[model samples]
Target: MKIRKNTLLIMMILLTVTFMFANTKNVSAKVTFNKTSKSITKGKNYTIKISGVKSKNIKKVKLKYNKKIIKVKKLRKNKYRITGKKKGKTTLKATVKYLLFDYTPAVKTIKCKINVKNKAAKKKKTNNKKNNDSEENIKPEIDWGENNIDKLIAQIEQSKTYKGTLYKLNDYTVFNKGEDGGEDQYGLITSPFYSTIDWYSKKDYDKIMNEVKRIVKESKITDDMIDEEKAYRIGRYMVKHIDYDYSVYGQRIYETLFDKKTVCAGYSVTYALICRYIGIDCDFVHTSGFYIDGQNMNHAWNYIKLGDYYYVVDLTDAYCGQKYDITGPFFRESGYVDSKQMSYIDEKYKTSDYTKDHKVDNISHYMRCKKNGDMSQTLTDSELYNLPE
Candidate 1:
């Protein structure tokens, strides 16, 4: 009986030792992040794969960056694939929780150094050359007719007579109120006119010409600086000073310029006029199917052609007020408007290549092509023939 008892005690001790050893083995699972070269371009997509993990009871594997979840994908038993977009350094890790033992946890992690290349770095150089070539190639299409200042002034005055008449939608009448009951009125009231005139009156034209020359001489503004940066700066400045008031519905140019009050349309038109007066090539763009908080509406904005590319400038968005709950000014407030937030003037704007985060809906215009051959109302052959030769 004594020997049997001793044998039983020895068996129990061996079993306990074997169990402890098994518990310390950790299931022999390993994890690795493939493609750790750590170099990628900004605004591009990339993928990473995690392999070498061996565990049947593993639940989930999470890949994180700076403690933020980057991606999580399951592949059968112990494999995973993670994909991420954006540029920045990120932390990577994998965790496996056993199903049977609630307390058993398996964790492994590594530090990944990621480098983001600039998206525009290569395109910018090529774009610069293309811009210079296009600028040189562009020539004025309209004939000024013998530099006849008197004739120009007379024509401008005649056009001005139709000002203040509401613009009718769908018709390009320069003076009379537009069709659709002037609902499409875009410009503000100025002296005798409600709509924008391509040519100014004698007095205003002379003053504007003098101011242009003065500005050129003083170097306050230059043709070279009339690019995206200049437009952005002007947009920011205008939005800062102008107060958005929806009550001034269908208000003409005079009200915005003198009263410093206007809506998105007024703000855009006013800015475009100012830019034109300063010798910048700009135009008003009409976008269809616009929405404020998801309600569909028609909207207008400005598109400025700088060099070769046309950039969109929406003054309303540039100067939009902060959310009521948020306090203080936006950090990094320079021309850093998020393109995704804008509703473009054109509906069929190029969007496939861009990521969802960079996408903006309801685009009314692209500056490069606004009122160009494709979108603008052109004088038909018959209409041109009707004009007196």
Candidate 2:
């Protein structure tokens, strides 16, 4: 009986030692993050994988982020994946639990740092601040091209597709080799073809020229008017007379003059046409502007040369459905009557690509075609013939 008791004590000691060793070795797993840190752009995705989870009895692996729970997807035998969901600095822990032989569970955790960058968001914020500052700090200038005057005159002369004015001024005509002889034709010598005339029928073309003549005659605009005065008078007349048309569609010039209902295009084109007829240098300036719908659409306006400097003339905004003495001292206070015309326009059209109205001391920037944008949005047959219903 004594021997048996000694043997029993030895067996109990050995069993206890074995149990402790087994407990210490309960499903040991090595966890490592595929990446310690990662950067991702906003609205983009980044994934991290954890490997070396050697425990076969692993019940599950979990990843927590942004106050949300994520069940790690098993990539293979002992690998897991965690996808990031938010921007900024983030820390995540891979928690793994597994059952031991005795059915008891053990937990192991490993941590990793992740940084996500939202460059797009940051850029937008910076751009807004810069745009506000640019209005005053930046000066606006137009390239006007290598042959600005000749190009402008040619555009105007070629615009007479229906043939009211064979020549607005003698300078508008260039010698071209015709079947008869080298005849003086409209447009530049380099580009003599009437490329924009296909859209107008004889009647429509006649109406366009006749309307231009009518505006000149009615406004009493003559060669006696200086360029600066002519530009201002035209702006004032269009704003006071032309009603802002929100619904009028199709022919812009016709609707502007005949119906007295037109949008920016009508206002701008009418201004350009009148300017060209009266010998004031002007052109249509097109730009991409945010509309009431919060979308960027192609918008139209005008730029005119006044003395040695150029100015932006936005008639659509100037009218404001009221008449004011454009020549009064009140109008002359800011060197531009537009400050009295509409304040909203003063803000909306202040982009560096548009105008530099805040710094009225400097000449305004021309809303010229930047890169891929078209330099001209003339109501040519190529652009206007196919209406978008």
Off by over 4 Å in 2: 1-199, 289-298, 321-389
Best-fitting candidate, scored by TM-score: 2
Candidate 2 worst ten-residue window by lDDT: 189-198
- Model 1, range 1-389, lDDT digits (tens) per residue? 99999999999999988875575354333345554455655443344544444345556655455423234344334434343445565655544443434335555553455555555442332434345433223321222232222223333322233334423211112323334543322331211122244333334434434432333333233232324433444554456556777777644444565577788777766666556544455655555565679975666565555544344556665455531111222112213334433444443333453223223212222322344544221222232222221
Pairs clashing in candidate 2? none
Tens digits of per-residue lDDT for model 2 on 158-257? 2222332232222212222223343333231100122211123335545765666566556544342345544565666676677876677842565678
Highest-scoring model, lDDT: 2
Model 2, 189: alpha-carbon shift in Å? 16
